[model samples]
Target: MTSLPPQEFTSVARAEAPLDENRGFACHVLIIGGGASGTLMALHLLNASPDMRVTVIEKSALLGCGIAYSTTDPGHLLNTRVHNMSAYPDRPEHFRDWLRQSGMAPGATDESFVGRQIYGRYLNDLIARERDLPEVSRLRCVKDECLRLEETPKAVIAHLGDGTCIRGDRAILATGHAVPVQSHAVLTSGWDFTPPADPGQPVVIIGTGLSMIDHLITLLRNGHRGTITCVSRRGLLPQVHTETKPLAISRGHVPLGAPVSAILHWMRGLAADAERQGGTWRDAVDGIRAHVSAIWRAWPEAERRRFLRHAASFWEVHRHRVPPDSARWLQEARDRGQLRILRGRFEEATMGEDGLIAVRIRTSGGERVLPAGRAVDCRGIRRDPAKDSAPVIQDLLARGQSRLDPLKLGIDTNEWAQVLLADGRPSRRLFAIGPCARGAAWEITAIPDIRVQCAELARHLHAIEAQDPVGVSRG
Candidate 1:
């Protein structure tokens, strides 16, 4: 068997094939988001079934550039390498191959860390090519927002903001990472960066994670000479992506359903052992990425909460890493006394009599007030999705159609990506994938996990339709 890149798959290689659409329901799938998740779902559905139609409605103009990949910065390289960033799980080298064929990165290799903007272009081109294909005629890309969704006995109707209602056999919630709006920090948009009126004035950023790094890079690129202060609870920065030797971790090696404490001990021991073998702790961290979801699901609610409270931050810093160049630049900024990280949590911000902004932080010493000319909330992905989810998600929750996860990470869903209702019934009509299903699978937020989830859910829907045609709207 051919060896897959580190982030592509788990222990063993398995074969996948499209189901016989001749025996399946020739239905339509309405996806609310047209980012990577939605595009991947549509592709898989079209490939797996012959007659199924997929209409992808994205509020943004682009098809596959979600909040994460929409950035146009050349300096912002993908955290993961080319080999692991493919939109297809089975086609491990698809992205690498695309890079070479498209001349986007003619010399790109499996280890090449290409610019995110180029990757965004790659996704856009990928979907664009698919849509133009006669075989993929079932794929429809709509530029609109689904404001409300209504499920009928025979169909699902999506009401768009433009006064257009789309009726399909089934609806999917692929709306990725919705950051709850209102930022008292005054700088809400991470991707859209406007040069500060006074570049020399001190700037305060709210989080010390990847988002923070993104803003920092933008600031430096734009020649901002001001001192930057990044605030977070522990002020932990993400590690940098590095070359990793394969670590063969068997499925049985993971302590499934065990206490979070035991899991933590195992990870520490694993990292220690890897270091002893001349490999970095990163080997141990990357080794467990595929199994985190299973371990997350196996834990009791109490144990899950305990992990979140105690070890989640450390895990995240090691797990979700930055590009090597970004890490090096960050180090240089720190060395020059231009960037400093504050160990505290952002509480409030207020406008002073002067034009400056006073940002308040709750620290161990006491409540400290930091005055700055500008402030931004780089709080990263773990935002309050319950309050600021998509318009359709909010409507669903208000109408008791769907419920939030116990931890409020995102909407609650079952293992098969079926949306769980308030009454705890699985929603055969509505399904969620990608970040929205983070509560169900913690790793689904990344491309590797998301591609697999999309593939599985597409197969699952086809299989279900084969048994019972008419699919979700049969009610």
Candidate 2:
């Protein structure tokens, strides 16, 4: 990735004023959700324009700590390496430098998997510096939830939970993940709470992904001597991260618009060749990370659905991996007979008289019943936007301002992050970034992907501003 140039400030300063009409400050860019994605969006925008007014709305008081970073557990290490996790693509070592300069990880190396807390603080400090840029545009951070959005011919109005409305020339939704759904006998394994209190009891964790790993770590660290059973269709845990020799594959090396089967075959041959050459298959996998977006876009809708139904889990397990320390801990737990990973479908679950949950799973051989003291639904968030319970997102769909993509993964968006309406037309005043745009960009959640997105989105918005300097009728 190319590095962005350092931000330059002009001698234009705007007075800090309230968002109401009395102050006469309409936001040039209104960002909903002040997480890593939103903060990056704001930073890129401010860096590009010294006179543009931007407003960021966050439910929490903090600027950059989202669910991923809000966890205080030191055991929750970043899955990605330090060098690739930088917020700025141009300054690749920005985060590593910050880690060393802030005395958090004084001798942090590029390959180090630092704690998520340290990265959260780095993001907070970065947002602070950009928000307080000298003689630049006003960057207001609002500690309130955005309830609904109303798109007008000239501007977009966001209604807040506090019964206040703020208007902006353009609005971008970066609301991140939705709350996961849980069955009657299963619990949502969020970081907000701990596991059940029974040391020698058995527990069933549905899905064996990153969240499941986090739940297991939390229970183990708390000295829970229970049997942890992780059940999924494939029961495939993420591969452990290892040193990689970068493959020689470029963006266009792999053919696009091919059938899903052909794509799989091509990838398999690449991986096999890498293995024969005494290199890890992970190198081939990482080689194509930059082209996933284009490949996904070119894929037919039917082919995309086929991939999701058959290969999504396999793709996820290999694409997202854990740190070396995490892998060792998991291996040790399994060896101690305290953990079990099973490949099966968790069928009907019943709550027993003694408060235990009896889950029936269908394996290859036969059906088996497991009596667990607790059951956690670690299937992660439902990706379909139509099924999301988020107030602002639901309101958007109800008002016909936006529609879910055909694949149901996320909201419909164009290549430039423009939100598409129910009539299959792009909204002139509304856009989406981050997970909300996952329907269009499949590999966008990671820091490396989002950093480039933020820079590109800022450039697109700047082009629009240049077209309409008076901030009217940007369409």
Candidate 3:
């Protein structure tokens, strides 16, 4: 587990070896995005094949944090319990063990929710440890944004922002999510925040989901005693998690051919029956989660769209539950009259004089005008790859090398996550994981689910690499 010589960690331009010819380069895999998915993928691949070469290109200088875990605000806490936050399923206590070994409290078993920055540090430390592995000597990480990707006869060429290109036999797009979108008027008017404004001034948050919660925490931590308003169509906050009993429902018991509405009706009835038998609905939901993927697969595209349009928000709020502490804090904030949650549609927004923004919101009661000192858009990432602004994704789309999913969930792919082309054919050497594969597999975002996918994908990549013995040079 010795460190590679400093020279070997130099920039791509100054590396000892020159870029391979357009003919092709022999490498195990080239992974894009050094966030959780990409880093874990690299670790899995390296662990499977010590002789294989793996390179991770990260847009941000920091690796492993990605968008969800990158916040520095102490108030931005993880919503899940520490015990269940392990990056690997097989290692159920991995995160808890790491916490203890790092000199934190021992035998801490409460559903404790810690700061997001602390979680980021844990992820970074894990990556550092993995990099020290003897097998990881074959792993190379590049700190550059990928601008374009082209699949050649022999290899895939990844063009970086710095105008340099690298080729690999296989490529993986773990690009993760994009930044939240802001209103066009806000951008054009150059309405940016200068903190420490009057505490009583009003502020509007664009989305009432988890991101909005983060903004609320930030505003409070900044000592802003202002009236904070979070507006969304459904005006739903994340559901709070609670201890529950287990159920006897198995995957085979759930009918697959029924319409989604019918399924929901059946599920509701089952939950009611469970409640009559002295069990909570939480038990039923947990039972359904065990076979959610199967249910999702059984649904037709129309049914899926119906669910998205009618029930996605409700599902999200329940599926992504909040930790008890954060839930209490939010409740307290509301009870104190400092925070307001409005359910409505965004009508329009205008800039006013003296650092003020007027937002017109439309609710069932009618239009209401609210003045805000500052506005923050926290709607979360755009999931449609066709509308994505990332250069690498755009390049692939232009060349017909990759196609967007029918539902625009992200890129099109098979169950194995092999990226499909315009002609609806899966590429042998190009695979995708994480949020990018949502179209192919609905439930792939959570760490536990993603780790399993990475493990399985790693096995596939390793089998392929074994057949082709590509020798990677070590420093």
Total backbone clashes of model 1? 0
Could you give candidate 1's per-residue lDDT for residues 1-475 as a string of tens digits?
1211223211111221221122233787889898878878887888788768777888877777787777757777788988899988888799999889977788999998888777766777777776777543566677778999888767788898988788777888999887767666455555556668899999998889888888898889889999999999999999988888756788898899989889998999999989999999999988888889999999988998999899988998999899788998899999999999999978888878888889999999999999888888777665788777898998999999999899988989988788888999887788999997788877788888888888898888888887776554332
TM-scores across all candidates?
0.92, 0.92, 0.88
Q: Candidate 2 on 1-475: residue-level lDDT in tens?
A: 1111112111112344567432333237889988878888888887766656788888876666677876667788899999998888888899999989977788999999988766777787887776676754367777789999888777789899999988888888988776654445355454444657787899888889998888888788778898999999888999999998757876667789998899989888888988989998898788767778888998989999998899878888888899998888789999999999999997877887887889889999899988888788777766456666467888888888898888877788888888889998888888888877788988888788987998898877787676764442333
Ranking by lDDT: 1, 2, 3
Residue 225 of model 3 has an lDDT of 84
Which pairs, if any, clash in model 1? none
lDDT of 3: 0.72
Cα lDDT listed for each candidate = 0.81, 0.79, 0.72
Ranked candidates, highest TM-score first: 2, 1, 3
Q: Using lDDT as the measure, which candidate wins? A: 1
Q: Cα RMSD (Å) per model?
A: 6.9, 5.3, 5.6
Clash statistics: count for each candidate:
0, 1, 0
Summarize candidate 3's per-residue lDDT along 54-112 as a digit string, tens digits: 77888776778787766656667777778767777677787887777764435545456
For candidate 3, the per-residue lDDT at 427 reads: 79
